[model samples]
Target: MAHITIYTTLLCPYCHMATNLLRKKNAPFEEIDVTARADLREAMRAKAAGRNTVPQIFIGDEHVGGWDDLFALETTGRLDAKLTPRSD
Candidate 1:
């Protein structure tokens, strides 16, 4: 399976929802709580192109954006494709 990583905040509703969807899909992910880690906040911003919002998601180096983007991918049926393990 592709590795999932989400930079999240402790009390963000979108963060909770994003994680929930991943769980429902039975996907294992690395949840990095950036609520308290200012260090991580800067790192997340750099990678996310200044998107300093909660729940910045990445699927094996592919940026999936925030919760809404996640839902869009799921609705369009492309999320499963992104989650599948690549032969590389």
Candidate 2:
């Protein structure tokens, strides 16, 4: 299975949208809620390179940025490609 990770908050609409899109693709993901966790929130900002925003996503080890980036990947039909684990 593909390792999809998303840092999100309960009140963030963009995070919900991102998760919704992933659900549409039948992709399983780990949703880390950063609302109540200060450590995770700081980690998200660091991992995202100072982008202190909700919904920092990662497909495997590749950092896919925020909701907009994920949407772009979907629109370009590359989301599935990234979601598929390599056999070789």
Candidate 3:
């Protein structure tokens, strides 16, 4: 499986939804809480190409955006492919 990283805030509902979906998929992810850390938030923004939103997700270096983006992937049945590491 691809390594997952998500930048989130404690009170964000979207973040919770995103995490829940990942849990259902049995995907192990590193959740980085950026609620009280401006530096970390800035880092997330930089990594996300200036998308300074809660729940910035990355799957093995591929930026997956936020909850909506992730959900779209799931709904379109494209998420599984992303989660599986390429054998190349």
Candidate 4:
């Protein structure tokens, strides 16, 4: 599986939803709470191309954007290929 990282805030509903979707799909991910870390929040903003939003998701070095984007991918039937573990 690809390395999944999500930049999130404590009180963000989208963040929770995003993580919940990942959990439901059994996708492995690391959650970074940017609300408690100013530097990480700034980094997330930079990665998001100046959009200061919660739940900025990255899947294997690919910037997958926010919760809406993630859900969109699933809806479009593209998220599984990126999330499924590769067999050597």
Please report, in order, the local distance difference test score of every candidate based on alpha carbons.
0.94, 0.92, 0.97, 0.91
Per-model TM against the reference = 0.95, 0.93, 0.97, 0.91
| Candidate order (TM-score) | 3, 1, 2, 4
Q: Give the lDDT of residue 31 in candidate 2.
A: 92
Alpha-carbon shift of residue 3 in model 4 (angstroms): 0.3
Prediction 3 global C-alpha lDDT: 0.97
Candidate 4 collision pairs: none
Give the number of the best model, judged by lDDT.
3
Cα displacement (angstroms), candidate 3, residue 50, comes to 0.3
**Model 4 segments more than 4 A misplaced:** 85-88
lDDT of 3 at 37: 100
lDDT of 1 by residue, 37-81 (tens): 999999999999899998999999899899999999999999998
lDDT of 4: 0.91
lDDT of 4 by residue, 1-88 (tens): 8999999888999999999999998888999998878899999999888878888999988999999999999999999998974776
Better of 3 and 4 by lDDT: 3
Clashes of 3: 0
Better of 2 and 4 by TM-score: 2
Candidate 1, residue 57: the lDDT equals 97
Question: Per-residue alpha-carbon lDDT of model 2 for 1-88, expressed as tens digits?
Answer: 6899999999999999999999988999999999999999999888888888889998998899999999999899888889997789
Per-residue C-alpha lDDT of model 3 across residues 1-88, encoded as one tens digit per residue: 9999999999999999999999999999999999999999999999999999889999998999999999999999999999996799
